[model samples]
Target: MAYGIETRCIHGEDGITREHAYGSMGTPIYQTATFAHPGVGQSTGFDYTRESNPTRSELERIVSSLEKAYDTVACASGMAALSILLELFENGSHFVCSEDLYGGSVRIFSTIGANRGLTFSYVNTADAELVEKAIKKETKALYIETPSNPTMQVTDLRAMKALAEKYGLLLIVDNTFLSPYFQNPIDLGADLVVHSGTKYLGGHNDALAGFLCSASKDLADKIRYIYKTTGGCLSPFESFLLIRGIKTLSVRMERQQENALKIANWLKEQEEIKGVYYVGLPEHPGYEINKSQARGFGGMISFHTDTAETAKRILERVKVISYAESLGGVESLITYPMLQTHGDVPAEIRERLGITDNFLRMSVGIENGDDLIEDLAQALKGE
Candidate 1:
């Protein structure tokens, strides 16, 4: 029987048959570096850990199923996954990317990619015309982050897909903000879907991992080749943790979204708050577009305090929410993008994107909605 997404999350799409690992209910972690050959010429499917491992393979399969992709490549980190995807283009090829992306992404593209002779043009991808105008003959890809990191800018995937088709360019989406449970970019005609599995997919701030999923066999093969060659694959133990985290993704996302909406609304009512940038809020520019394309508005919210001093005070005073860098964990995290996630971005660009000292980004967790709101209220009140 075909199952719903919730069912798929728990039992997986294929329903977890016991054929793979000697009837064990849970997928076994294959920790060895190398596998022995059955005979002189025959060998086990897995030869080396760097090339492939059973545990990581299972994690990749589950993620691919979730994204409805032909295949997925598991990597050491989100940047590693992006590095593999960038390998599709030749050294001199260029890409048009979202202006307000994660700071680490911008750092890598500007430093590492630039060192390798790859070039990128940063634009607000929500404006399809601007993205089109930014593309040159050397541009090979349209890379974007929807409900963009820290800023919560949403890009229309269908519009980007149309542009990519017209220019014969690949459409790569960073789906880290909204996990596959809320948004599936591949279903919207994305050529490649990338994620930071360490965030929502892991659910806990425990493991570090990344994933790249694609429906095109050719693209999948190219990613796999680069992934194996670079040797930045996720460890088997981390893969096991990722699988455990993914099982509860549906329930966690629902609770997180609920809490986020309440918090965002409460923030808007507070006199100390300047603005709230959450896709769920009707005042947000991309609220309607996000509603049309995604199942949920997601739990990430960025708000500005009346002053930079107030922002710093709240960061130090929050007892319930941890002051941290990462997001999408069970525990709520509040980060100052100016000195944290977007610190690497140039000052001019950061100012233009509104990632300023007065701004704070929150990743709402599965905590009780009222308690979270009360905690924020107390923090804002300097109690």
Candidate 2:
């Protein structure tokens, strides 16, 4: 029988079995740096950990299956995955990118990639016309983050695909916000899908990991070559943690989204709140498009308060929700994108994008919805 995504999450591309490793039920961590060869002419496939490790390979295979990709590369961090993917483009290549993305991504493109002869144009990718206008003859790729970081702006993937095809540009999507359980960019014609497995994929915020998935074998192979050479591969222990974390993705996401929707709705009713940026909200501009493309609206929500003072008070007062920088964990996290996630973004650009001092991003967890709301309520009310 063809398995559902939830089942696939548990079983992975290849189902778990004892036969694969001397009757071991779980995937074992091949912690060694090098696998011993059977003999001079024979091998055990894994010659070196950098080239490949059994534990990491299993995690990659699982992500590949989840994303419906021909192959996947596990990296040490999300930036590492993106760095490997960027290697596909040569020097002097330009890219059209989403204006509102993880601050780290903007930093890489503006600083690191710029030093390497790469250039990028940032636009509101949700507006296809703007993206089209930004494209130049040197543009080789479209890098976008749907339900973009603090704003929750959703881009039309099919529209982007059409543009990419017309321009013969690679379409790279940052699927970290939704995770594979909620959205598969590959199914929507993304040339590549990048993820910060450190967030939702790890689900616990304990392990840092990243992944790159691609349907094209050629693209995958190129990325794999860069990944190996760069030596940013995830360690065997981290791979094991990620594999374990992915098994509960379906359940965790379901509960997290459930709580998020409740919190988002509650936030909308609050007198102090100015706006709630969550795709699940009917009033959100991206509601319909996000509904059509994703299985869930995701647990990320960003809202604005009446003033920066009020926002800071809430951030400091929240007792149940931790004030942290990362998201997609089981524990609720509230981030100030202005000073945290989007700090690297230029001040003018951030103001234009509405990532202001009053803005706050929340990664709702599996906590009881009522309790989470109560926490926010007390925080907002300064109780």
The TM-scores, one per candidate, come to 0.98, 0.98
Across 1-383, the per-residue lDDT of candidate 1 in tens digits comes to: 88788877766778774556677767788888999989888878888899899889888888988898999988999989988877778889899999999999999899989988999999999999999999899999999899899899999999999999999999999999899999999999999999999999999999999999998999888888888899989999999999899999999999999999999998999999999999999889998898888999889999999999999999999988999999999999999999999989999999999998899999999999898888888888897
Candidate 2 global Cα RMSD: 1.0
How would you encode candidate 2's per-residue C-alpha lDDT over 185-267 as one tens digit per residue?
99999989999999999999999999999889899888878988999999999999999999999999999999999999999
After superposition, the stretches of candidate 2 with alpha carbons farther than 4 Å from their true spots are none
Q: After the best TM-score superposition of candidate 1, give how far the Cα of residue 169 lies from its true spot, in angstroms.
A: 0.2
Clash pairs, candidate 1, are none
Error of 2 at 348 (Å): 0.7
